[model samples]
Target: MKHSNGAQLFLRNDPAKTAPLSTKKPLTIGKASTNLLCMPQTDGVADHHAVVRWSVGHGWLICDWGSQEGTFLEGQRIRNCRPISDGDEIQLGKVGPVLVFRLAPASSQPTPEPAVKSSAGGNLEFAGQLIPMNQIKFVQLLSRPRYPASFSWWALLSLGALVVLPWPPAFWTLELVVLAGWIVLGSRKEHVLLVTLLDGMAYRHSFANKVTALGHRNGIRKAIGQPSSA
Candidate 1:
């Protein structure tokens, strides 16, 4: 079966209960009648449990709406808004319901480029090079952490020391502040866009802003006649 544009969610236990995500608005899940994915009879679900929406800079994200039982993304109870990737599982509550996220499928056939000259349309600007959209064979996004796990682990160990060391109140406060900084810094990632040409050559462009990288990748996909996973 084929899915509509944008992303989609299917029930974990029942894939047939698939719902496509909206690009124009948020998809609300709850027992309330106004919710797009309303489950009036579902247990453990609140009136406004959670919402899935698209952010221009962050792509697709799922945020808990202060539900009685918080939402879980792959078993981890999400604190705030968390970016959703393809194949991620979202649980409504501790035991309410489960939904799977999926990206739109690519076209089965290669898109035929128009007869106009490549220069007819403006080329995609990338790292100071002009690339014809038709020359792109594939596009992929890569994300890598800016810091190693050990940095965060050391911060955790320092925080753990306070429990047995009987540190002063000021010292405790300083440790807490440092740990917070470590967490925020550790979570930073570098996003890169990889574009492969039909001739087998490939090029990558890195972006400090995830939204800009996603936009570039999606634009290339659309220009090449493939479905945008945005």
Candidate 2:
């Protein structure tokens, strides 16, 4: 695919073999072609089954190349060409091999600065909260902890309190409080990082950091087509 941004195709069933679809040429997928980028070993796959192409304006596209069984995307059979987005599943031939697609940010586009905007004296709007940037002790991106919504420390403390408390009513109340907290603050999307800001008052805010510091560093390298620093 001729994508300005890099694209990746991963085998959904067998995630070991991942193909980088960052080249300008269209990636050919088939059963027995030396020129093919992905050659699945499943039955019903033709020699030239399908082609995944990309362009700057149109984005990524998957086109069926007159295969016998046909190409299916997310269970529906594609007529000829279909536009695909990140996390879209592409099945070459009917029930042959499922592949997941992911498109990175285009290297041509400029990286935006952190979404901090000045409002008052040394204060800025960060994650919908107006707080003094200077008061921020640190900022970091945290992946969703295994527990539902509460922070790890909060969970541990609450659990310990429940264990030590002798009153049965108090234990149940604490459990209900934890459950309510999870219900109120739990995120719906998986794999999204939470941007946390710790301030002088020991208060923390968990907000979405679309462009994290680490992301900024890596994005700068990707935008310039430079090798990432170790």
What are the per-model C-alpha RMSD values against the true structure? 13.3, 16.1
Structural RMSD, model 2: 16.1
Best by TM-score: 1
Instruction: Kindly report which residue stretches of model 2 are placed more than 4 angstroms away from their true locations once superposed.
Output: 1-5, 38-40, 105-230
Q: Judged by lDDT, which candidate is best?
A: 1
TM-score of each model, paired residue for residue = 0.47, 0.42
Scored against the true structure, residue 27 in model 2 reaches a CA lDDT of 81
Measured by TM-score, how close is model 2 to the native structure?
0.42
What tens digits encode model 1's per-residue C-alpha lDDT throughout 1-230?
13545478988899877887865678898989999888999887899999897654466789899997899999999977899888999998898889999876555212333322234254565643457777878899998887768485766767676665685876677677777877787889989899888899888988888998887778677777778873
Score residue 4 of candidate 1 by CA lDDT. 48
**Candidate 1 segments exceeding 4 Å error:** 1-6, 106-230
Q: Model 2, range 1-230, lDDT digits (tens) per residue?
A: 22224477888876667776743577888877554564656776788888887643356788898888899988889987888888899887766878888777676423333344233234433332445654544443445644563556467867797779879898878877876777556654223422233533433334345345456434333333335453
Check candidate 2 and list the clashing pairs: none
